[model samples]
Every structure is written in C-alpha cells, then in structure tokens.
Target: MTTGAPTPAYRTSTSQQPRRSRLRTLLPLGLAAWLVLEIWLLTVVAGAAGGFTVFLLLLAGFLLGAMVIKRAGRRAFKNLNEALQRGTAPGQGGGNGLMMLGGLLLMIPGLASDALGLLLLLPPVQKAVGAYAERRLRQATPGTLGDAFQQARIHRPDGKVVPGEVIRDEQ
Candidate 1:
C-alpha cells in the first residue's frame, strides 16, 4: 500500500482518440479494382462490337446524362417556385438528387457506371438508397439536436466556428 503508482485518472485513454475508418484504407484499392474491371469490359466490348460502337455508346450516355441532369434541375427549381408561391416549405421525397447522381454516374464513360446510374434512376432503387442514407446519417450523429450544441458550434453556410452557450430555465 505504501508503494504507490499513478491512478487510472492520470493515464491517457486510447479510446478518446478518433478511430480510422475502413473506407479510408479500402477505398483506393476498391477504386483500382473497379478501374481495371471497367477497362477490361470496355476492351471486351470493343473486340466484339468495334471501337466506333463504343465511341457512339459513350456519346449517347453523355448526352442522356446531360439531359437527365438538366431536367432534374428544372424540376427542382419549379418545385422551389411552387413552394414559394404557396408560402410553405417544399415537400421532400422527389428523388431529384438521386436522379442527378445517376446522371453524373452515367456520364462517367464506363459501362458499369452507366448500368449503375440507370439502376439509380429507378424509383425503387432510389427509395432504398435514400432510406439507407438516412439510416446511416442517423447512426453517425446519434444525438444531433440536444446537447451536441452545448459547446462551440460550426456555421454551415460560412464554415465558421464561434463560441456559444446553451441557456435553460428551470421551473
């Protein structure tokens, strides 16, 4: 009892340090594999259907993706106008963002990406992806609204951090 060591409070906890995500390690590798696959598929198609056909296909995909993006943007603007006219917030669940994402993927010049984009353009796929994204966001910030704002907060629009305090009144 006389021979004393530092208490647990004096020791630093490793848990307090931020953990690395698997995605950080695996994403590069995954992208490399995908690139290789895309190249291989393109070569195979070229061998079967000539180089000009691939060029035509890519051009068509680019044009279609552009059209899709333009349409989605217009629709989103129209929805915003309609909401402003009604003096109410715009309703959600239109999948316009997903459509834009699909368009982007389609324009990427890879058949696999085009296929994935087309899949994302589908209503059911958009619903499933949106649900999954929502769940992931909820999980990432488990307690977003309440005590998370107790300390200094970051302003989203300007990316500024300012000190602040939360005031509560008890009855």
Candidate 2:
C-alpha cells in the first residue's frame, strides 16, 4: 500500500477558473451583439433610398477585411504550429483567448474593429504577444517552466560528478 500522492501532468498553475469562465460567457455575447449590429447596418443602408451605392461599398470593404483577416489567421496558425514542433509552447500569453476576442471585435459593424481584429490576427503581432507572454513566464519563475522541457538534471563542469535533476534508477 502506497501513501504518497501522484504527480501532476503539468507544472504551472493557471489563474482563477471562475474569472476565465465569466470571460468566456461575455465573449459570445459581445460577438452576438456585433453580429446584430452588422445585420442592422446592412439592412438600413440597403433599404434607404440613394444608399445602394453606399451599401455596395460597405460590402466590398467588409469582404476585403474578411480576406485580410483570414490570411493573417492562417499565417498566425502556421507560426504557432512551427513553434510547437520546435518543442516550445507558442501563443503563450492568453493566446487563443486573445485571438477569440480580437475576432469578436473584428466581427463588429465598424471598420475600426475590423482593422483591430485583423491586426491582432497577424503573424507578427501574434508572435509578439507570444514572446511577451514567454518573457512574463520567465520573469515569474526562472528556469522552472524551461526546466519542464527536459527531465530535471544537474550537471557539474570540470568533471562528471553531480546529481541529476531526475533519477530513473527505480527501474
């Protein structure tokens, strides 16, 4: 019969769970509100007299913004994938959540929100965000997260005498 507890899968601890949940709930609501506004704008502009031309212009702008955002998203995802393959965690800082919020903002009826969202979706921007997040993590706990990259080991120079970070001799 053993008395010790099992080890955890991941080393780092996340922030409050309920706060994250509340944000998740609000995200969808914001998205929905923006969508409603977009629909209303489209209807109003198209329905008004002498507004057909304006409607078409707005439509064109929307399509262009969508295309730009799509391209940016693709690039961001590719970079994130590459980072993961290199054994480094990518999109470190609130990445998915940030992207989601950005996308939601982009989905709003205004050109400003669309531009902001597309900026957030860009590969360079995403990378910057990830790097900032990594830096913060390192600042918070030096060598702890990186230590997880490989098995804990301690090595000494000028010779070969030191206790490793991990011991697997239990085998």
Candidate 3:
C-alpha cells in the first residue's frame, strides 16, 4: 500500500520556463537593438567628424581591445601559476575568469561591449564580481570550500571514487 497521498499533477508555470527558451527569445531582440544603436552612433559621429574620423576611431578601438586582451591574458596566466604554486584552485572566486571574459568582450567589435569590458577589468569591479560569484557557487554546492579543496577523486559511472592524477608521457 502507498504511504502517502498521490503526487500532484505536473503543471508548467509561466515563470518556470527554461532559461534557454528565455534567452532565445531575448537574444534576437537585444542584437537588433544593439545594431540600431551602433548604426545611429556611427552616423552621428560620421556627420560630426567625417567618415575618416569614424574609421580612425574604430581602428583605435580595435587596437586598444587587442592590447587589453594581450595584457589580461598574461595576467590571467600569472594568476593561475600563482594559484597552482600555492596549492589552491585557480580563480577560486572567478576573478581571473572574469578578467578573461572582459578581455574577450573587448575583442568584440562594439562600443558598448568595449565600455563594459573596460569596467569589468577594473580591480574594484573584478573583486566585487569575484565575491558575488564565490557566494553564488557556495550556495549552489553541497560542501564547504575546505571540502572542495580536499577533494582529489572523480566519481565513476559505478559510483566508485577513483583517485585523480595527471600523467604526461613524452614520446
């Protein structure tokens, strides 16, 4: 005999739609808006300073983005090395990851994204974002940071914890 009442019927709530569906609906709209705004800004700048100036600005932006990407990439590698040497997980709080993201954003060809990338590269903003990410990750996981640090095995398909090790074979 069943021990409890029947389960309620499965019902879909309007607010419970999958995140991918929501993103699919919003992505096109956002892209169109960005294109329109970019075009408008381009026209205004061209009218004020001529087409050559606009071209120069775009070229300058591209150069700046390249430089930012190069610098951020180097810094991220440095941070990763330091973390490894200290026996800690790299990007424990997501700062290095965010820095890489910011650099990639800068690489993208758009004024708004470049501005956002520059902001994300700032030390204060990176710290804030890292803290927020760490908090969210902690809330989503079952164990404390210490437990995560101590974990050095992988759960296999049969539910056995296999010891994890990195092996490099040079031919």
Candidate 4:
C-alpha cells in the first residue's frame, strides 16, 4: 500500500523575497528625528553667544568617536583571531550575520547610529554571544549531519544496493 503524500518535486526556486529590513526602514527616520532634535538642542545651548562653537564641538565629537571605533574594531578582530589560534573558542564572533549588520549600522553617518553600532561591536558583548553559541554547539549530538548526508550518498538501483559514486566498467 502506498502512503497518501504526493511525490516531492526536485527543482525549486529558493530565492528570498525582496523586502526592506525593519531596521533599515526605521533607522533613517530615527536618525533624521535625532539630527533635528540635536540641532535644536545645540541652538538652545549656544543661544546668541556662539552657536557655531556648539556645531564645531559636535563635529569634533563625531570625529573622535569614529577614530575610537576604528581602533577598537581592529583590536577586537585581532584578539578574536588570536583566541581562535590558541585553540580556545573565541569570545568574539566573526562571520555572524547579526555582527555584520551591526557593522553596517556603524557605517551610518550620524553620531547616534554610529554610537549604537560601536556598542554592538564591543568585544565583551560579542564574546558573550559567542560563548552562548559555543555552549549550544557542544551540547548538540555529534555525527547527526554526517549520518544524514552519508545516507544520502548511498546509491540504490533497481532495488539492488550500490554505495558512493557509481562507476561503470568500460566495455
């Protein structure tokens, strides 16, 4: 007797939908609002004495913060690599999708966005995340993926068994 499920199709398109990310949609609006508010605050603080000085200070702060991030980012990646080389699981993560997003957020031109990105890029924070991931990986059963793929690699023809890549004898 045959089961009722339909035969599965082999070929299918697996492309993801083209939708703007939620953060991408919201971040620009948030940055614009923050820029307006900061400008207003700077005007109020400077108040007829010297608004230009406040703007200059803001510019200086932005430059200093960017420099700090550049330096720290380099250090964090270097240490992360060292940890991996020493055979201890690195606290910091590389090739993580979220961390990449955080880096992109840092590349935004405004102080607020840059600050948020830098916070995300912090080594301690990344390390904590990496530790959690390592724990999960350690707890997983070994050979699960290997067994699944091994079963797939077996070949069966006409109800007779064949294993691995099938090679035919040349006539």
Candidate 5:
C-alpha cells in the first residue's frame, strides 16, 4: 500500500510557474524594436529622398551582399579543399565567416544594417573583432567550452580546431 500524503484541495506555494529563458523573454522584444527602428528610418529616408532612391539603395545593398557572400563562400571552400589535399587539418578561421555575416547583415533591409555590414567588411574591424573573440575564447573558464577548445587545439595538426567532437574508445 502507498504511504503518501493526500492531495490538498487548495493550491500550494511549492507549485510555481516555470522560469522563462532570458533569450526567450528578450529576443522577440528586441526583434520588434529593431523592426520599428528600421521602418521609421526607412520612412525618414523616403521622405528626404524619394521612394525610388530608397528602392535603388536596397537593390544595391542586396546585390553587393550576394557578391560578397559568393566570394567568401568560394574562398572558404578553397581553403578547406587545399587543407584536405595537403592531408592536414584546416587552417584557423580568418575573415570569411565574418564576411559572410556582414553579407547577411547587408542583405537585411535598412540603412543602419547596411552601415554596420560595411563596417564589418573592413579589415581593421575584422582583425579587432577576431582578436576580441580569441581573447574571449581564451578567457573562458576551465571545464567549459574553453576546455574542449584547449584539448582540440592541442590535437590539431596546426594547433587549431573548429567545431568538432573527440571520441576516445576506452578499452
């Protein structure tokens, strides 16, 4: 026979609502704000310069973004192929990923995004951003993702690793 307490007729304080994740709570709000800002900025531009000018700007940004994306993709694939041919691990990431990101940002409608995308395309900006990311990865706490990276770095032929997993067949 079960020996547990009977259920209470009234609700108890122990039963609480599940906490929402920070991303879940804020992402929609952030997207909404960004959309509003983009729309407002586009209207302002349209008022200052005719709608045709705005249309031209959007078309230009889209075309440039597509070109940049194509170039970056080709470069990245070439690098990978060369590394494979050499029978060695791939080289560390350079600006290709960031360039792709910039291209994607440029493709998004809005002058602000276009400006930010252009900035990302700059060599100096890419270097600074790369350095910052490197610093962050190095600074990550032990036993976390940082540890995995450290292990992977040690094993890679060029002492570099991208997204990967290690499996040891323990005997």
Candidate 6:
C-alpha cells in the first residue's frame, strides 16, 4: 500500500536538533567583560596620571607604532629581495611582515594589543614565530610548485603532461 519513493532519513522531532556549544554562548559575554575591564583600567590610569598625560602617552604610542610599521615594512621588502636573489624562499623574510603586524597592533588604542605587539616585534619572539610557521607550512605541504618545476620529468600513467602557454585575448 506504500508509495514507491523511500521515506526521508531526517529526524522528525524538534528535540533531536543539535545543541550549540556553551563556548559560543559565552563568547560575547566574555568579550563584553573584557571590554568593561579595559575601560575601567583606562579610567583608573587616567585618573591617577591626569587626562593630558594619558592623551600624550596614547599619541606617543600611535606615532611610535606608525614609525615602526614604516621601518619594518621597508626592511621586510629588502629582506625579501635579498632572499629571492639568493635563491631562497621569500617566506624566510616573514619577520618583517610580523613586525609590521605588531606595529599595526600597537597602533590600535588598547593596552593588551600593545603588549602583544611589543612582544611580536622582539627579535626572539619573531624568530620563534617564524620557525613555527615554517615548520607548519612544511608539514602541511611537503613540496611546492617550485619543486615541481625543478623536477626534470614526472611519470603519470593516467594522464600526460601538456606543455603550453596561454595567450590572453584582450577584448
């Protein structure tokens, strides 16, 4: 007496719906709490040091961060060029980029971000981060496109390699 079509596999009850994680519910609360704490800390510091002094300190931090960004960006580009010339991966010069990011973080008006930025700008921290990133990248992808280009021949039973260049047709 049943139709030819099979029944759907989905659950019929509303209670069967997946429950969301507590972390998701708590994230906004945590962020709001942190923001309140930061505001309170800033207010206390300003009260102790005077508003004018706090303004000057914030201005100095912003200016210092901008200068660091400019200097680090230049140095990173220089290092990238040198690495390329020496037949090394451009990623080896990622420290400069990290420094620039640190500088950017410092430019943001927050004590925690400024502290993190300063840490990232440190030579030892930059080195450690760079090494960790390099290790992860290597583990994720054993060989890159550059390695494929360096290989003389590739053996594939399923498909033949087609060697050709595409000419863009600009309309």
Q: Go through the candidates in order and give each one's C-alpha lDDT.
A: 0.87, 0.65, 0.77, 0.65, 0.89, 0.80
Q: For residues 65-143, write the lDDT of model 6, one tens digit per residue.
A: 9999999888887888888899987765557778888889888776666777889989999999988988998898779
Which stretches of candidate 1 lie above 4 Å from their native place? 1-19, 143-171
- TM value for model 5: 0.72
Q: Ten-residue segment with the worst summed lDDT in candidate 4?
A: 92-101
Please provide, for model 1 over 46-82, each residue's C-alpha lDDT reduced to its tens digit, 9 standing for 90 to 100.
9999999999988998999999999998998999899
The TM-scores of all predictions, comma-separated, are 0.72, 0.35, 0.61, 0.39, 0.72, 0.60
Error of 5 at 120 (Å): 0.5
The digit string of per-residue lDDT tens for model 5 on 109-132 reads: 998889889999999999999899
Candidate 4, residue 13: how far the Cα is off, in Å: 26
Question: Tens-digit lDDT track for model 4 on 1-171?
Answer: 887988877645456546789999999999789889656665676885586775665566566556655665776788788998999966633535345545565554444555565666677877776777768976885566678677656744456656657589999
lDDT of 3 by residue, 9-95 (tens): 987887888566888999999999997877888888789999998788777767777777677678778888999999988765346
How would you order the candidates by TM-score, starting with the best? 1, 5, 3, 6, 4, 2
Q: Which candidate is the best by TM-score?
A: 1
State residue 1's C-alpha deviation in candidate 6, in Å: 26
Off by over 4 Å in 5: 1-18, 140-171
**Candidate 2 at 27: error in angstroms?**
2.4
lDDT of 2 by residue, 51-71 (tens): 666555556656665665565
Local distance difference test, candidate 3? 0.77
Worst 10 residues of 5 by lDDT: 156-165
How many clashing pairs does model 2 include?
3
Q: Which model, 1 or 5, shows the larger lDDT?
A: 5
Query: Of the candidates numbered 2 and 6, which has the greater lDDT value?
Result: 6
TM-score of 2: 0.35
**Could you tell me which residue pairs clash in candidate 2?**
152-165, 153-165, 154-165
